[model samples]
Target: MNWKNIEGLDGVESPGLLVDSDKIQQNIDRMIEIVGGAEHVDRLFPHVKTHKMPEVTRMQVDAGITKFKAATLSEAQMAAGAGASEVLIAHQLVGPKLDRLATLIEDFPNTKFAVLTDDPQAADAINEKCGDADSPLDVYIDIDCGMHRTGIPLGARSDALRAHIDSLSGLNFAGLHVYDGHLHDPDLQQRTDKVKEILGKVALHEKEHPSPRIIVGGSPTFGIWAAETSWHLSPGTTLLWDFGYGDAHPDLPMTIAAALISRVISKPGEGKICIDLGHKSIAAEMPLEKRFQFPDLPDAQPIGQSEEHLVLQTANAASLHVGDIVIAIPRHICPTVALHSHATVVSGGRVTGDRWQVTARDR
Candidate 1:
């Protein structure tokens, strides 16, 4: 839980999040350049939900990032308190959290607040809340491009949503928010085409409602979106690259800056070595179940995971002793990051600092 000036503990701690500030900066710069700098795009709203460290967000803002995308209202508050002028609550602000959103808006009047809503009821709630606050809230209509998880259907309903925002007393109609979460295909052309189709639909609908501030793309599709024209990218994982998306996109400079560094806590069987971290440390939902690479045993399978141990079946488990530290590259970065409270940053194999107060530790 400690997160401050761990400038000399690299060769000491068993295992923890290790951030290469160099690679982190490289990733940010690459994203900025790819997006054609701050002047060209409306605003580069980098999502802080991935790393969740205020220091990392500060770094992005230092590099000319003004807008931020946060999944939860807590994340939005965290980012805004950290000096982010504008924040997009990318998730629905439902139920009784309207007051919290209002508090965030009232406290940080300088910070422009926006929320995405597919349901008109939720939109009505948001509109009512903003009206009570007597503040103009920016609202983006979530488009169901490919990811059917959340977003409204992309059609005349989009027009209806736009009209609803315009009718609201204190809401500004921002453009569209389309995230193609299903386009994680390894095939380059297939992924590109899927995104193209989604954005093409948005473009078609945009003819009727030319609001002009469309937010799209994630860490996986940032490059693909950049290759196209007139689209802004919201890359959260670019700050702390993971085993899942980073394996395919090597052009991204960030690496496994955060890791579950555990010891060989137990040796239960012949060819299986169990580490201290499991679903509790790094969430079990990985990109690929059988795809895990142990530096000690390159051919190891990160097969099954329990609450507190990772079962690694390998041919050379004898090489791993009971006290030796082992690093685990989590399959999915977001939830894996949520497991830890802070990261032990390293540079040139020396511990530089501890980024504490991991902001995105909860739902």
Candidate 2:
């Protein structure tokens, strides 16, 4: 279970998260390269919900990506504090959260902060909270482009919401925000057709209303949206890819940049060995087999999983012993990264004695 040439592996503990800095830079470079180059970095507004760290955000900033989209106030704060020119809290804010969003704007006077709003009442709440601020808060009308999530319907409702924001004293209607997360098809042509169908509606609406800008697409439909260069793209998982998206879209240029390092702790049965990774270590949203995969032991089958232990039954069970270190690639890396407090940084094939704090976790 030993990794041949990874320096400083002996010092790392079991069930630790390791992030390769080189791969991260490569992913960022690939995204920018796909979108023409550094000149087109502004077209990308990557979501911060994936990595949720100031260090990672700083890397994007250094790569000429100035705008970011976040799901929480903490993530927005981190992005702004990390020197991003603009930050969009993509989630709707209501009640007291509106005040927190306003405070974030007040705290960072130079950075532009915006939020997504689907409900008219939520728009009113945001205006009321930021009424006395120096400037009106930028707002985007979230459009329900077949996701049926938290967005105003794409017809009259969307128009009415946009008009309502325009009339508000403390809010400025920026544009439309569309997330096509449900369009994750393994077939490239199928995904392309779905994007054409959904984005067609957005184009029609733009013809009537003439929006200043439109932010569209998530990780799955980034390449689809990229073809329509007029719109802004917001792809997050491209930075730290997981097995789920990578396997589905092998044509993508990015590689897996994050992994879970665990150790075999016990051998309780004849052909079974228990590892330290469980639901608490990796993401459990998918089935056990799809949640993570073992590269060293590809024939291993996950037999049992609990809060802190994972039991595997494999023909090579006898080859592993207690304290044997293994690497696991998470199927979904976003939530798997949220479960940990910090990540061990690796660079030049060695652990760099640096730990990145998961800043926006549980915020």
Predicted structure with the largest lDDT when compared to the true one: 2
Instruction: Tell me how far the alpha carbon of residue 176 in candidate 2 is from the true structure, in angstroms, after superposition.
Output: 0.3
lDDT of 2 by residue, 1-363 (tens): 123257987789878898998999999999898777888888989999999989999999999999999999889998999998999899998878887877887899889998999988988888888754457788999888888877877888988888899889888888989988888899999999999988788888778888988999998889878976568899999998988999999868788888889989999899899999989999998888888988888888999899999999988889999988878989999999899999999888889999999988867
What C-alpha lDDT, on a 0 to 100 scale, does residue 349 get in candidate 2? 89
- Please give the clash total of every predicted structure, in order: 0, 0
lDDT of 1 at 337: 71
Models 1 onward score TM values of: 0.90, 0.97
**How many backbone collisions does model 2 have?**
0
lDDT of 1 by residue, 1-363 (tens): 121223465354544555666667777787787777657544477899888878788888888787899998878988887888889999988877888898888889878889898877888899887654355788899988767799888777878878887887778788788887777877778778888887787777777767658899887778788778577678888887777787776655565655556678878899988877667777556443633444445677775777777777878788878977666666677777777777777665566655567875665
Worst 10 residues of 1 by lDDT: 1-10
Q: How far is candidate 1 from the true structure (C-alpha RMSD, Å)?
A: 3.5
Error of 1 at 350 (Å): 1.2
Residue 47, model 1, lDDT: 91
The collision pairs in model 2 are none
Over the full model, what C-alpha lDDT does candidate 2 score relative to the true structure? 0.88
Candidate maximizing TM-score: 2
